[model samples]
Target chain A: MQQNNIAIKVNGLSKNFDISESGKGFSGKLKALFHRKRKIITAVDGIDFEIKRGEFVGYVGENGAGKSTTIKMLTGILVPTSGSAEVNGIIPFKERKKNAAKIGVVFGQRTQLWWDLPVRESFDLLRVIFRVSQSDFNSQMKKLDQVLDLNSLMSMPVRKLSLGQRMRCDIAASLVHNPPVLFLDEPTIGLDVLAKESIRNFLAEINREEGTTIILTTHDMNDIEHLCKRLIILEDGKIVYDGETELLKQKFVHEKVLEVEFHDDGNVIQGIPGVTVIREQGCKKWLTFDNDNYGIGEVIGTIASRYKIKDISVNEPSVESIIRNIYNNRVTLAMPSEKSPTK
Target chain B: MESIKIYIMLFTTSIKARMEYKVSFLFYIFAILSFYAGQFGLLFILLNRFHEIKGWSMGEMVFLYSLQAFAFGFTNLIFSQLVNFDKMIVDGEFDRVLVRPLSPLGQVIFSKFEVSTAAHLIIGFTALYFGSRYANIEWTFYKIILFPVIIMGGVMIAGGIRLMVTAVAFWTLRNRSLVHTVIFSSKEFINYPINIYNVGMQFFLTFIFPIAFINFYPAHFFLDRSGSGLLHPSLEMGTPIVGIIVITVSIFSWKAGVNHYQSTGS
Candidate 1:
């Protein structure tokens, strides 16, 4: 029964937080000491998804869309109020230590390393904690050092390293035990372009070579487009979009922008059938056309007949715009009702 | 075995981290020494004036005081990380511990083991040595064996108390006042014989909170004044047993808190 392939399976998982309404000012705080208003905030509302082993899934959502709440549940840090979550076929919350042994987690906001010790020493401590054999630890370290370029950072105290260096070391540390599943939450949050690329490459390499299941959550659209083949978008604690990344681009309200340079007076060009002129420069006009309705050759022909010959370039919708479109129209999109929403 | 290895590794690594700031580490030692010296000075002044507190002599008082200090100092060295555990919960940093393949409580205890308690140990040992010499108490071989057992038991009791208080934060989220009064401020009450306080207060300290077992009750066995304290003369032997019971109850309390957190997470 293909049970072993399911790295993570979540069913009807929900978490509701009770936020006490405390009033402002001294008297309000004093009054709150006696009694405070309580409101229940549903963080994750009955989400269901099954991620197969070796799947690279991007868990994208707006702030407060329950990305972290869901991650905590899957990581066994938070018990979902209702429903169940199984990691590697074991209920995570019921068996945190066992689950932890099989999963590696990285939080970009925090470092799990010992702050004052050398980075290399922290890895050894982790080795001891996870009960990895000496040979396995060495082999893992060799692989990590090669991918992460951790040679220079290993000897330095963790606090002395730059954020980027520390992050790379963090990722490498998490993978030391060779966990079958890795969860990364904004692993490239504050890193520069090169650092982010390095991390992305490392992640991609690890997923490919080791067949590690990765569940990544990030605000960075590049992380999604470049690394993740599958994307799961959450809106207001509900699954708004979940499927192939390419399919997401194709299905969303994404339009192709054609930038045309005029050989003659481009200002004279006025109308085109079913095309919106989004931007107009002195000699260039940027027109957006629905890719589904119009082919690029057809659009170019329409513009070619109307205007003088010119150089033209067509632009596909960027991943950022596609994700933005999803978030903007998430509520209006046909919501996933009480049924399996795993596309 | 794995837990012990991990604990030692964590403890040593943290100590190594502390050594990185040599001047700061020395300052910690100096500060603790000065602070304990002042506490002992206060005790010295009070005992000099009163001479005897409810039939217990000055040397006897110092023995009790040192015992309390010893128990607290050792326990604090190990469990000082637990002092601000409420803050850890409030800041949502405890999630890091939860995700680890170890007991959250054990991780907290081992990873943050404090080195600043060395000065307290020095002060406690010095006071105990002098107190025993001055009091001229006959030391037996079995008495020597029971000495460490009594201290370890007392430490367990204090550690249990700390664990319970810190675990309370899982519900309240912010209860520094309770932690402060119950853990730190209450240490002053056990500096002298518990019998000096009113019988009601003595009973409360003995039965309800049990800070008396840490030193006052156990000290009676050494001071040859077992029957005079309160309740039962044989209660002096109850330190280790009471420790096991208290720690068991507190561990249960800690588990309950973790369950509550799992159900209603921060």
Candidate 2:
């Protein structure tokens, strides 16, 4: 994507909140009412980034890291204390209604559908709200059905549906207007494997076929790995890292695990350089070696020549571990080559 | 035009949902009837014993009581959501309305319809007509035409007051009891004759809160009696216009409140 093809641009966005942390009790409540001291918290401290059209971006952060605040600012729900953001060429806060018509938002913990109405009725209501033409509504519903598999869940009341089923419907409702931009805040949180897979596939298909620009904030590493090509990581209300997904992994993950099984019960291989034996049993041992320090082939050759090995397997660090390492500030790996192709 | 249709659909859906539980619906109707009937019965016994209080006959007091009751019932029917606005704000449901294309106040006002309150309205109107006949007010075509205008204006004033109270919730999250005091205090003031109060208190009701215009001035005109020798025909007809202005201001305040909503976090 070209830099000038930006569909969403955020500059110097900041949000501060006065949080009162009064303890729980009647006396605590009274103290809060009379308390003179106030503590200020900067939720989003001057974050800046741009998202090009049709790009799938993952926004990752720890709790209280301003991920939700950034999403709210982009979606026109909260006004930033300073700085500016525009979605589809409209200032989100100033032109909230127009911006809302051009963007779709879904928070995982909340449902926009009417609680007492069946899924079909809520869709009808949404169609009216968005002013979707009959032909357009039909086409959108057909596309959503094929992607989300929402046929069986239409007749059920929203409150009666399972979390996964409800999330599918919620996604469909947000897209009733055929918004060009979409914001998903932890859309796959608390979902089972099957449900997560379905959502991931649906999101991928939409971004690919319809050219919908998607900004997803999630704690699920699999969601980031499978859906996003570009990734931004937030920490302490700041953008600590922003680049391609592969680069984020390669830059933060330097170690690879090696699981070795010995033919003899008493066989032990020690004195291996540049590797740590994290775990060991009677005939098996797990060793972690920095890939930057030693090649996998060289390490395996040294180990095999020394001991009679039954089997040896190398494990690249999972995306979850990579992210945890970055957050923990243990070590920084080199950035991957930028020539890597997008899937 | 589309908003009117939406309101009708919302009201119909609320009625259907409320009727789904047959036993509860019947119980609600009975409970409202019994409660209002008991209050009316106590007023009747008091009027019977006093024969007349401060030169106002029993039928005339009933007219005042019925007028206040009718206006209260109409407001309760249409604006019951205002009474529970604090809950809606705290739950973050108001954020949903703000995101929609329609005005947030329009959506919140039409979110729920209290059909059960129509029972009280019907009862109040029945008493008003009977009380008018007993008081021997000369029937005229103009009076008949003006009755609906008075009722609608009364609804607007009461609804406007409720709107103002609900707007405070945008700043203070939980204060429905404060709203109740604002509503009930006005109702209590309007239940008796405005003439019984001193000039200062009467002026406060007429200008500050404006509860007097809701029923008292209109009732004075319809009954063809001056309000303690102070009513003027021109002012009697003009009181409801003040209500229209108050309702308009309330609507503007509601819009300001929507702008000030700071939505809660997940």
For model 1, residues A51-122, the per-residue Cα lDDT tens digits are 999999999999989998899999988878899999998898889899999999998888989888899899
Candidate 1's C-alpha runs over 4 A off are A263-270, A335-343, B90-92, B133-136, B140-142, B226-230, B260-266
- The DockQ values of the predictions, listed in order, are 0.56, 0.40
Report the TM-score of chain B alone for all candidates.
0.92, 0.90
- Candidate that scores best on TM-score: 1
For model 1, the local distance difference test gives: 0.85
Candidate 2, A1-343: lDDT as tens digits: 3544888998999988666566569888788788834678888999889889999999998998999888887877677888988888888777777888888888888898877667887888778767788899999999999889889999888889999999999999999999999999999989999999999999999999999999999999999999999989888888988898987666655678999998886766678888888888888988888777677888999889988899989886777787888788764434443443321
On the 0 to 100 scale, the lDDT of residue B232 in model 1 is 85
TM-score of each: 0.92, 0.89
Per-model C-alpha RMSD: 3.5, 3.6
Docking class of 2: acceptable
Q: Write the per-residue lDDT of candidate 2 for residues B26-114, one digit (tens) a residue.
A: 99888878877876675566456645656666677777777778788889888888888898888877766656656567677777776
Model 1 has a DockQ score of 0.56
